[model samples]
Target: MRGIQLQLSQTQKVRLQKALEQLESLSSKVNSDASVTIADSIPVNHEDGVLKGHGTTDLNGEVVATLCGVVERVNKLVYVRSLRSRYKPEVGDIVIGRVVEVAQKRWRLDINYSQNAYLMLSAMNMPDGVQRRRTALDELNMRCIFEEMDVICAEVRGFQHDGLHLQARSQKYGKLSTGQLLTVPPYLVKRQKQHFHHLEQYGIDLIIGCNGFIWVGEHVEARDDMVEDQVNQTDPQVLIPNKDSVSFEEQEKNYTALETRKYICRAANAVRVLSSLGFIITLEIIKGVFELSLSSNLDIHDMLGSEFCVLVAEKEAERRSSNKKKR
Candidate 1:
């Protein structure tokens, strides 16, 4: 398939063209040698092929991909290229992100994208027996439920000017404290979206996002070394679910929960090891580093899980900086 670009309507085109022309004139004066270029930056498969913006010019006349989209007169700055696809969470998409900042009405998540996402108190499912609307007390109690670095499974509610908003309507979607956080480059993470699973052998659960933010955790308190033992066993007996005792739906849900837990835990372990090594890792990096195959013991979650530990690394760096200050 051909590479995709964002599409734009005629009105958007006219607006972009005018901006480009103005930017070109400005560029000529700003840097006599540098060229201000704008090509058809829309994606082929993008239904809304909007010309979002242009790129940036360095002092040495080299060009870089634009980080922010254009808003015409706001920046009057010549856009050099359209923003690269960063895979921020969208409405209705399931994602996993680490809680970074906790505020009055929302929690901030670094979703491995351009913008930090917001998880609002209003978006959360209220208590089972509560008859009234969520109160400030509810928010405070909920605040205690999540601390910095908690991994959460949530659905993107929508995007606002502030950031991407997330909702956790189910018990499955809240307070993921016992897990390792993984961070990968956004693009490769998107490619492995369909393969999320939890392996019974691995005793882990995995939550994957297009932005490369993965959350991994143990399904139960199992030893790390026991993982290999369980996965290597050929007992087809253990793999089969008990069909006689439960309804198909119940069985299916149980199997899914088990699988999700296993995948997340295994990925968390893998990510923890790699992130400790101080590499700016991606899903591709993990796949390459581990030398894994598609059909191997590792799953899509394992690859993206290699990018884990941004928060821990940041904290360590801060600690060192503080220690150095004391010296």
Candidate 2:
């Protein structure tokens, strides 16, 4: 209950416990009532307990229901209907992930499920805006876009025909180049609906997965004035402004955006990596991973390696492909 957010209050917990105890105490007396037959076995009708149901057994040797009032007949099925949650990944779902390994032309991601998900090089879009099939030149470094601890977001691309392939693709789907990653419980991740949808508010690129993996990184906000500052395509916005002359409002907004972006980015990356390790990716885990001298060691530049993380992710994808066949 401590781990679950939807836990009952202390008063409710005590009341529920008392109610269960009362039920247990009254159970025997109710069964022995005269109106009840107390048959060698509960009747089939009562067993299901559906119709003033009594605990009864059927030919299949299963209890269908638990009857409370009278044991009218024997040799009947009675039991409470059991239920279970049976959900699987879906397309278009935004997922937070870490590149666990890279092999060949793919990246493997731990999407907080039983199996690590895959992202293929062919699914990658080139920076030059050229739409060509991924080539040998696209050989993954396994650490470029998705490092061992990088967090990323992408759309669910549907599984392969073999039922083993888990893919995520789309331009909207890409690596979080800056931010923190945090890992909450899998249950919390499942209940979250707006995963990665509100990053613009905080200026962080956030990705989350049902498996409790999350990635956070910094993203520079689009600047209206900077739009006209694009002097060259290769090296846009060359004019440097004096740091002291910047207005308080602009500076405040930029600083706030930068700080929020870094905070979320780090949280997201830490969450994804933590999810992959099957542990709660806390600030402690992050410090340990980077071997930081101090908390301040948690800088974006140290952890956000775009190319390296990507290659690591690709390797993970290759590993997932291999495991799927064995399954």
The candidate maximizing lDDT is: 1
Clashes of 2: 81
How does candidate 1 fare on TM-score? 0.45
What are the per-residue Cα lDDT tens digits for candidate 2 across 231-314? Answer: 123332343344347687865665545467555645555444434323333333443433321243645553433322332233
Give per-residue lDDT, candidate 1, residue 147.
Answer: 56
Give TM per candidate. 0.45, 0.44
**Least accurate stretch of 10 residues (summed lDDT) in model 1?**
222-231
Clashes of 1: 34
Query: Relative to the true structure, how large is the alpha-carbon lDDT of every model?
Result: 0.51, 0.47
Top-TM-score candidate index: 1
Once model 1 is optimally superposed onto the true structure by TM-score, how far is the C-alpha of residue 296 displaced, in angstroms? 11
